[model samples]
Target: MGKATGFMDFKRQKGKEQPPLQRLKDFGEYTSRLEDEELSKQGARCMDCGTPFCHMGIEIRGMAAGCPIQNVIPEWNDLVYKGQWKEALQRLQMTNNFPEFTGRVCPAPCEGSCTLAISDPAVAIKSIERSIIDKGFENGWITARIPKTRSNYRVAVVGSGPAGLAAADQLNQQGHRVTVLERADRAGGLLMYGIPNMKLDKYIVKRRVDLLAEEGITFLLNTEVGKDITHAQLKETYDAIILCVGSTVQRVLHMEGSDAQGVIPAMDYLNGTTQSLLDGVTAPINTKNKHIIVIGGGDTGADCVATALRQGAKSVHQFGKHPALPKKRAADQPWPADPQVYKLDYAYEEAAAKFGSDPREYCIQTTKIVASSNGKLKELHTIQMDKITNDEGYIYFEEVPGTEKVWPVDFVFVAIGFDGVEQSIGEHFGVKVLNNRLYATMKNYETNTAGVFAAGDARRGQSLIVWAIREGREVAAQVHGFLEEKNIKALA
Candidate 1:
């Protein structure tokens, strides 16, 4: 609203990324922040629409259509346009505890729902948010503030990913004694290891974790809730327990030769490589001069392909079981929703630049993994899947008779998503595990066990980081209220 014709005058643009070829040489952040003036112009494209759907956060077609964190989008955009970065940061944080994290890895559903996107490209919300936070850091605006009052109510959080971090931060801010227990050697379960350093640097995660610690949120690393310390001990030690233990069990491809020597789960591969990077050593799953195949088509699978390329894989093939998306959004998938349009991820870009061909192969089904005589991975047998509509008008994939092919393979990374919350966690905590393999939490995020609650992927199954943070904040508010109502009857 600062400039009446701002949206008409300004164009949409995002920050620049390091060239695919040059960036593939190492694991580091690829995108660079724009200059303040350039970023302000990008912010000017918000237009101050009377009905801002950017922060509405409604779900369309079962997927999020806007910002899940309900970020005060237009307000901050106006602040950024006015060159008041500190005020913008304050507005951004009013609703979001960590705009910095969402600014980096989120898919930016907000952009999808932007009114401007219905006509032209959406406002540069992600880059603008990033610029504001980075400016806050540069000006020493972000700092740990000790709570003015201490309720002394002890709370134990059973993960340090986004959800656990958010819940812990909120509960600690309300003067509760918060302790986050992470089974990993470090905090940030998925953000630390599941995502590659190139997408989200571990130092950024560590910086926030360190800040939380400085603000008196104690983090117990390398401590497994069920193993190192029993569930009963944790319950006795803390007044409440919030289970943010994410859906960790990776889905397995139970195919022929699945037990081959070189096949590995996506998390195991991703986590090991990241830990090695942190330790200043070469990654263990060295792909130099090796043919790599990444199974599954989700972001994690895409990440596997990108990681292999960076590690000098001889060749890479990223396969998706389903058919390729349309170049343009389909009729059924219209504007304002997150349409599945055909797009190349950074991995495909790197592979195309390095090998002169895109790495992604669609409609692929791995029927078997051929093993060598020494019980190692030698080749992978695959079949092309064709979509067939049955007489009843139902569509499903069918194997084209005689379309089987075998290709030499050295490593296979299964990134087919998660099975559920780890069974051991539910069992140890004595929480009800639904048939769907996720924890059974009440509407308010409480499990059957008193003083025990679940949030994030543990309760909702595999979901976005923004959703996880929302769950974390909402659950913390509920838990704090529950603590206050010592003698009140709980809602059914």
Candidate 2:
């Protein structure tokens, strides 16, 4: 503990955010960092529990309890409080490979699991984390770490997302030559396109990618493994291969008029917007002067709402099948478990500011899509739902009687979720797709094919960026071990 009574003395404080309406005018980061003195006080608030559940990195009741990458929270907090930012950054990098990305986008389950959160507000761990990394970069403390030695082993990493990048970083540090193959023109799969620029700037993603390249990790852009090259070629060329392709197949919303012209997937909308932004062109799917309807609820749905607001949508509404989360943590979500509490996310805040109210409609289910005579999406038909519990304790949603209503909508962005990795990639790599994810042994991250491994969303299903980074690090260790064992056998 930096100070024995620091937690009692200082209240948790967060960084300031740009006013919603003002921030919506441009695609830039909205949050501003606290000053050094305030940040030190925030760090001093760390109680530094003996158990330190903040970094246990475990799951409780199917929900994350703490930091998935197991960031050393207390030690870094102490270092930050003592004005040792360089030391804090070093402690942070001991586990997390990309704090910049996670600090911005991650939901911060670690804060929910903080020991201090049991009573008072949780430590502003996320803000402090972002500050440490940003300061490190500002001070030129963060740079490429080139390995002193080199191994003859060469590894090919598919997909340039968080997982693939982390795997490449780790493998390269182990003296292995690693090549990251990305289908997109730019690296950082989800970070580059799936997420909007306002949340995480492209410049931040590019800066890290450039640093990795400087450290000798080769990034092959616009070259897909199964298309530009074949699996057979990869097998012949690299000593080992790792698949980190993310879960990208969007879940379909089957309904009447599903083929309507204006119905699009959430990723499609986000990707198109980001690509056009980077290419200096107009996005094909513009929400300007349109009544936008976002189907489903979660971070993606929230993001869609925010994007539509920025695009000058005339009106916006988001639909969710689930009821609103309680303002306080429920009994089911106890201490040490990430609580499902209600609060306005960044998007909701923006929507409320622009539209006079929050645009989210919970406990509502879309039943059908109504199209015009020209087959263009005209409106959406939805019904209110009530939560029902059966005799066996199974829960389901039942449509409320006489609750059907029509919503005027110019476009519908389906943000339900993703199924898994694209099937063609799995088939080409000869990896079995079970439950919409690549079949890989959890113990070793090895797929059925020899010298081929899988990790990240492709193997674990859709998940957080922090989890993806953790899987990437673990898979690299396994790959290094497998290569070393093979080398010894060959010598024998």
Candidate 3:
């Protein structure tokens, strides 16, 4: 929109990342922030279509295809191109409350659905976004704006993750006395633990949390809603409550030797490592000089591979049941649709650099984890698999004949998936759980009980942090409306 020929003049250039060999040594951010001139050129690559799908928030081919928060991609793109960074940051904040989080961790679906991506490479939207916010930080444009008036509403947000933080930020801005409760020793939930430090620096998370506190949003750490503090006490204290407790229960493998002392959940390993780093103590679980095996080839598994390398793992291998992906997008995956394409992420890149081979092993299934004489994970029995979708469309992986193999290992991380939201929340709050899933939110994020609502992974199950932020903002609006309606009813 800034220049009619901007898309033609500028070629897509991704933000530069440190070489894996060097970056794996430390937990600092690897991506180098682009200079202003280069970022302006990147922003010029936006086509800014009349029906831009980048921010449409549509589901394509059964997968998310655009910015889940529906960010105004083109407006910010134009602003960045015109060197209006302050205005760009303002426009970005219009929809996304935390562009900084998504800028680093989100798998930019917006670029995948970009109009320019139909043929040419998509605009560097993610890089531009990060640049905008990073510039705002450097220029001191990002600061706390405390509300002048109070709505006289008191709200308690459970979970200090993306959803809880977003809800608390918006509610506090709307003149509500909002308090965020985090069970962890510190706030920021998964952002502070589940994710690795290199990808999302804890300083960034802490900075935002600190700003939120300055804006009058109270954060109470080391106090879980249903545990240390009673639910009845919260009901008596706050006028409204919103649950943002994410899907915390990690899915476990039921194979033999799965309970080996050295075998642990992915979240546990990740969380402990982060907590140890924050506390300036040794990690409870370490992969240094250990042959580590991570099960499940999802983002969590990839993160394990990267983290293990940083921890000085002797060797790392990640196994998955799914087959290797096709090199190009398949026919079913049309334009504007998110396709499950073959791509190497940061961990895989680091793994290949350190181990001289990719850590991800597809179409391989581990049948059992075996313990050694010392009662630690020693080896894993695995086999090759061929997947088949039956008449009912349930995927049944068929084991290849005589393909059993075993590999030596010291530590095993079960990164398969999450079960659902933690159940203790239901017992504590008397909230109704949804059928088929453990989610507990009703329409407009309202729970069955009055004056209570749920958002993020707790309401929608395990999803992207971007989606969590979106749900948090929406839930905040709903909370505001509910409170205003209540006040009107009392006046009447």
Candidate 4:
């Protein structure tokens, strides 16, 4: 431990964010990094518990707790506390291949499971992690470690998102010839488009992609297997293939007037906006002077609201099917578990500051969308709901009586969530899918088809970037083992 009483002496300090009013004006990163000394103090707050549940990654009450990739949180916390940033970065990378992405985007289950959070505030593990990586980049310590020799075995990774990138990186390190095929014009699938540039800059994504390319991994942008090239052709050309194409099909609200012209999917809106911004062209779906309604209360919905506000929307409103959670942890939730509590994310705070109230409407359901003569959406008709338990041990929602209301809206973004991988890709490859519509996988992420594997959102459905990276790394190990065994058998 860096300091015996460090946890007691230092209180947790969160990363600062730009003023809400100022940040709403553009699509730039709002969160500010802490100074080296301040970050060290935050890291010192880690108690480094005997059990260290921060890295256990257990499921509590059906929700994930701690780091999913089993990150060595305590070890790196101590290294940072001692001002050994280079060492801290190395320890952080031991388990997590991409700390920079997770540090910026992850919900930080490690902090939620921190022993210190039982009573006092939790250690700022996420901020400390970001600091370590930022220092590594500034010092030019992060460089490509190209392999000295080649295994001569070829592997094809379909998708260039976090999972696909991690898989390619691991396979390249193992001396295998790896190539990532992306259907999008640019590499870094979701990272390149789905995510707004404010939360995660596209340049940061490009920086990592460039590093991976330098390490001898080939990235084939705009080349899609099962479409541009047949799946059979890929199977014949490469010894192994890993499918990391994330869940892209958006779930829709089957309500009246859902097919209105102004109604659009959240991913489509965010992707379109980011692409336009990156290309220095005007966004096709401009929200200028429009009253926007975003359906859903998750991160994606919040992102849509933020994006709209930045695009000069006159007003915005968000709806959630579930009721707002309590400000503090509930009775059933305890320490070492991610609490179901209310907190204002950057987007929500910005909305509150601008609208003079929280823009979220909880326990509400949109029954129908009203459109104008031009077939453009004009307003949303919604009703409040209440949660109730049924006799069959099931939960249900009942619409509250006399709570119907109509809100003026010019644009509507459905941020309900994703269904699964696009059906076309799975059908073309003939991979078996579970009842939930996700890839059916067995040991080591291998599908029913031999030498064919799956990972990330495609295999496990829509999930965090951290989970995707873990799946990618695990699948790469499986692919490497399979290739090595084949080589040995052929030699014999």
- Model 4 residue 320 CA deviation (Å) reads 0.5
**Could you arrange the candidates by TM-score from highest to lowest?**
2, 4, 3, 1
Tens-digit lDDT track of model 4 for 18-64: 89999887898888689888888888888889999888887788777
lDDT of 3 at 244: 91
Model 3 Cα lDDT, one tens digit per residue, 245-284: 9888889999789888789899889999988988889999
lDDT of model 3 at residue 275?
A: 87
* Best of the candidates, lDDT: 2
Whichever of 1 and 4 has more lDDT, that candidate is 4
On residues 1-492, what C-alpha lDDT tens digit does candidate 1 reach at each position?
A: 787777899888888899999999889999878888888888888878787878887688887888887898999998888999999999998888877788888888898888888778889899998888878988999998899999857999999999999999999999999999998899998889889999898888988889989999999999998889988998788889999999998889898899999999988888989999999887788888999999998899889888888888998998898888897767876767777778787878888999998888888899999899999999999999998879999999988888899989999999998888888888998899998899898988999999899999998888888899999999999989977775254422
What's model 4's overall lDDT?
Answer: 0.90
Top candidate when judged by TM-score against the true structure: 2
Off by over 4 Å in 2: none
Off by over 4 Å in 4: 390-393
TM-score winner, 1 or 3: 3
User: Candidate 3, after superposition: displacement of residue 264 in Å?
Assistant: 0.6
Against the correct fold, how does model 4 do in TM-score? Answer: 0.98
- Candidate lDDT (C-alpha), each: 0.88, 0.92, 0.89, 0.90
Model 1 weakest 10-residue run by lDDT: 483-492
